[model samples]
Target: MGASQAGGLPVSLKLPGIVLGVGLGGFVDGILLHQLLQWHHMLTGTDSDNIGVKYYSPYTVPGLEMNTVWDGIFHTVCWLAVLCGLALLYGRLAHNRRRAWTSRVLWGWILVGWGLFNLVEGVIDHHLLAIHHVRGGPYRLWWDLGFLLLGALLVAGGHLLQRSGEPLRPRDADDEGGLR
Candidate 1:
């Protein structure tokens, strides 16, 4: 659908924003939770009791190695998502004469994208797949819930911001090209 029907944001810009947000948000989660905080790993919950595979320990040498590899793979996927977003943005804006970059719609969609990333990842990894938790302890559920709550807030906040922005209008054929 066109921008006017899609809440005033162009698909060209919105899609890329969301893609970039997901990638950047994943980087934050991977770096902050997995690396800096040392809270959990990709397969921390993959215990033999649950899946017939030995429990993964982030402390032991072998465990750490395995987790590290998995983390690397996760990061690679995030990087690829960001690259795809960049490619989309470049392709969409390359010939456009409008200054869409400065539009609030771009940032709003980015927030929505990041929120979506958190919600999807939190639900799939933390709940459905049961591959890991936000933390390993009695309070793990609380942490996971808190993560979901934050995602919800982001989505709500982003939607509000998007709605507050002016709708993007199509550029006239005679308009000069370049950012406004």
Candidate 2:
């Protein structure tokens, strides 16, 4: 009840919100690392400097068609976790409060997502094509891994705070103590 959602949106809509959050997070990662930072292309099959592929963004809409199987998979997982959280928080079968083990497990999965993001990004961008290093160093790959680890920690911290009684609603500002 404390969760401050819009007046008309149903609880079922939380799943889509979770999916969108995860997917948009991926989009930001791709844009920042691949486009801004110039780390790697969407698909690592070809070199970034390749004439044919360089100018063409494979993951974009028309000029370059692509597959987002991996992104979809991760988003699906995030949606499931978010659904579970919603269920535990509001569903008939669940208690009003989240269970301890459930929160811990969710935190663990967050770590998994972070690791997966790092592995896929690292293998494709750093190791395979040797584009830009993670942070421009001899062991830039390790640096990138460390960043992933930090993100995992942040997710875990966020979940822990949520479990401590913070609301899950997106629209609320002050009442929401941690990450959205």
Candidate 3:
């Protein structure tokens, strides 16, 4: 709830948190699975991968280069997400910036955002579009399912944590006695 929102309430950290989380989660997947482990690339998925032939995108140097370029584009989008999140966060803070940074509500929303990214990405990229996968093999379906499961868990956990948080406020805003 926020003043600009439909009802009268202070702004929550949900938007920024989710944006940051989605960006962070993308970074993790790109760095760990795509670059470091060489599990897959932007356009690596093909029917050949399903049969374990390991087509490697187009199976040539040019294809690898193209995949690399696509990966760069993906990274750029993720970077933009992070920037957008920061801007939203700055707008939300009144005089409790420090406390908001450490608030459970913010972090919880971030977790939810990350989970949402995983769910949406996994569903669209891995299953619907067939562009790529967590990995290529007979067990690819299992890996994809596991990714979705992890996303669900994060969402559930984040929701639970967010339920316990209060709205942000300036120091002593709610306390009549500032200090003892």
- Candidate 3 lDDT by residue in tens digits, 1-180: 345432435467888999988998898888888899988887789554333433445468988988888889989999999999988998776554677777788889988988998999999889887778898889998999999999998888888887788766433456553211
- Superposed Cα deviation of residue 164, candidate 3 (Å): 2.1
- Between candidates 1 and 2, name the one with more favorable TM-score: 1
Model 1 clash pairs? Answer: none
lDDT of 2 by residue, 1-180 (tens): 333234422223223323333443455565565457654444433343223333334446641343234334544655564565445435411122333224433344344444445555555555555443355445665766775665566456544543454223233345432222
Error of 3 at 153 (Å): 0.7
- In angstroms, how far off is 26's CA in candidate 2? 0.7
Question: What is candidate 1's lDDT per residue for 1-180, written digit by digit as tens?
Answer: 344423433444678878987888889889999999988888887762234446668878999899888899999988998899778776655335346666677677778888998899999888877778888788888999999998888888877777776645544446564332
Clashes of each: 0, 0, 0
Q: List the residue pairs that clash in candidate 2.
A: none
Candidate 2 structure, TM-score to reference: 0.38
TM-score of each: 0.83, 0.38, 0.83
10 residues in a row with least lDDT, candidate 2? 92-101
